[model samples]
Target chain A: MHELSVAQGIVSAALSHIKGTGKVREVHVAIGELTLINAEQLAFAFEIASHGTPLEGAILETRVIEARLRCIRCGREGKSFTCEECGSAMEVLAGEELLLEKLKLVEGDGDAQGI
Target chain B: MHKVSEIEVQEDLLAANRELAQQNRKLLDESGVTAIEVSGAIGSGKTTLIELAAKELKDYRIAAIAGDVVASLDAGRFEKLGIPTVPLNTGKECHLDAHLVSHAIEKLPLNKLDIIFIENVGNLICPADFELGAHARVVVVSVTEGDDTIAKHPAVFRKAQLAVINKVDIASYVNANPGRMEEDARKINPFLEVIQVSAKTGHNLQRWFNFIVKAVEDRKQHGI
Candidate 1:
C-alpha cells in the first residue's frame, strides 16, 4: 500500500523535528478526504515504519478534513464540485492535504517539558 | 513523572517527493526534453497508445521509461518499436516516484531525445499522488474498463492534463458509453482535455499526436 511510504514519511519528519531528545508520545497527522487514505492502514503502516526508531510505540492520530470546492461563477462554497446556487464548475479550495501537523513528545527529563 | 509537550511543526507528507519532482522538472527543462507521464490502470491500452504514437512520430528522437512491478514487458514492447526504452522494475512499489524517474533520466541520452514518455505503473490511485516531473500528465481510460471508470477515479482525472478514453472502436461491444465518460471527466476537471481514440484502429490518433507536438512547441516558445 502507498500508505506505508506515507507512514515512513511521517516517522522521518517526526524524528527530524524531535532531535532524538524525547520519546514520541503521539503523531498528529491531517489527511484530507480527497486524499482517500485509509486511517487504519496508515496507522498499521506507521507501526511497522517506526519500529526500532525513536517513534517506536508512539500513537498515530489522524484528522480527516472533508473536501471543499468553490464555484467559480457564483463563488459558492460546498462539498461537491457543482455549486448549488449557480450550478457552475467549482474550484478546489481546500482538502487534498496530507500534512504532519504536530508531535506530542515526552521529555527525557522527569519534570522539564519542552515545547 | 513524564512531562509531555506539543511540538508545533507543520510539514506536508509529500514535501520530499515534491522537492525531488521540482528538481526533475528543472532537469527536463534544461535538457529540452518534453516528458509526458502516461498513467492508467493495467490493461487500459497505455502500451498500445504509446506504441502507436512512437511509430507515428518516427521523425523525432523518442525514448521511453517503462515502469512495472517486476517484468519489463512494456519496455521490451517499446524497444521492439525501435524506441530506446528503459525498464524500471519498481519491485513491490505501487507507483513510480520522482526519485526513480530522476535516476532513469540519467541513464538516457537526454540530449539526443526530443520527447520522453514515462509510462507509469498501472495503477490509478498511487500514481496520482506521485508526480514524475512530466510536462504533461496523460491518464488513459479505455472503454473496456466501463464508462464509470472516470467517475470512479476522479482524483487522477482532476490531476491529469489530458484524458484519453481509448478503445472507442469497441465501446458498443463493451457496453460502454464514451460520451458519458468524457462528460464525467470534464465534470471532474472542467479544464481537462478529453480525447476519445481507438489506439487499435488509429482513429483520432492524429489529434493525440498533434496535441503532443503543440505542447512541445508551446513549452519551447513559452519556456513553460
Candidate 2:
C-alpha cells in the first residue's frame, strides 16, 4: 500500500533532520483530513518500514487536521464546499496535507549534547 | 539518562510527488496538450469510454496512456482504434503516479496530440490521494457497482469534478437505481457534474464527448 511508501518517507525525513543529533525516538507527523490516511494503518506501516533501520522501535505520532472550506460566493467557512446559508460552491482552504512536523530524538553516540 | 531534542523538520511528505505532478503539468502546458485523468473501479468501463471517445471525436488528435497493473491490453485496444497510446504498468502499485505519467508522456508524440486521455488503473482509493497533474479528473461509477458505491467511496468521488454512471441501459436488469446513485454523488460533491450513459449502446455518450471537447477548448483558450 501507499502507506508503506509514506512511512518510509517520514523515516528518511527524520533521519535527515536528525543528522548526528541522536537516534530517533518519535516521528511526529501532521496529516490533513482530505488525504484519507488512516493513522493506525500508517503506524502499522511505519513498524514494517522502519524495521532493522536506525529508526527501529521509533514512535509514530500522527495528528490529523480537519479540512476547512470557504464559500466562493459569501466567503463563509464550513465543513464542505456547499454553503449552508446561500448554498453556493465552496473551496477548500486547508486540510488536504501530508507534513512531517518534527522528529523527537534521544541522544546517541554523536557530537550533539542533550538539550 | 536519555537526552531528547525535537528537531523541526517541516517536510511535506508528498512534496516529491507533488513536484513531479507540477512538472508534468508544465510539460503538458508547453506541449499544448490537455490531459484528462479517467479513474474508476475495474469493471467501470474506463477503457470503453476512451475507445468511444477515440471513435466519436473527429476534431482532435487524441492519444491515451493506459495504466494497468500488468498487461498492455487496454493500450492495445486504443492502438487498434488508431489512437496513439502508451501502456503504463504500475506493477505492485495500485494507482498511476505523476512520475510514471511524465515518462509515458515523453514516449508519445506530444506535438501530434491535442488531448491525452490517461486511463488510470482501476481502483478508487489510491488514485484519490495522488495527483496525476491532469487538466480534469473524472470518476466513473456504474449502476451495477451499486447505488451505495458513491457513499462508500466518497474520497475519490470528492476529488473528481465529474461523475459518470455507465451501463444505464441494463439498469433494470441489474436492479440498479441510477437516480439514487446520482443523488448520492451530488450529496458528497455539490459541484460534481453527473452523467448517466451506456457506453455499449452509445446512449447519451455525446455529453461525455462534449465534456472532453469543452475541457480541451477551455485549456486552449485559457492556457493550462
DockQ category of candidate 1: medium
> For candidate 2, lDDT tens digit of each residue in B29-148?
889999999999999999999888888888899999999999899999999999888999988778898889999999989888899999999998889888889999999998888878
- Which digits, one per residue and each the tens of the lDDT, describe model 2 over residues A11-100? 777777767747787788999998867899999999998998888888799998889999888999999646897877777788878999
Model 2: docking quality category: medium
- For model 2 the local lDDT of residue B128 reads 89
TM-score of predicted chain B versus true chain B for each candidate: 0.96, 0.95
Native contact fraction, candidates in order? 0.66, 0.70
Clashing pairs in 2: A81-A90
Candidate 1 on A1-91: residue-level lDDT in tens? 6898888888888888986577788899999887767899999999999999988888899998788888899888998765778767788
How well does candidate 2 score on lDDT at residue B150? 85
Which regions of candidate 1 deviate over 4 angstroms?
Answer: A72-74, A82-89, A108-115
Predicted structure with the largest DockQ when compared to the true one: 2
lDDT value for model 1: 0.88
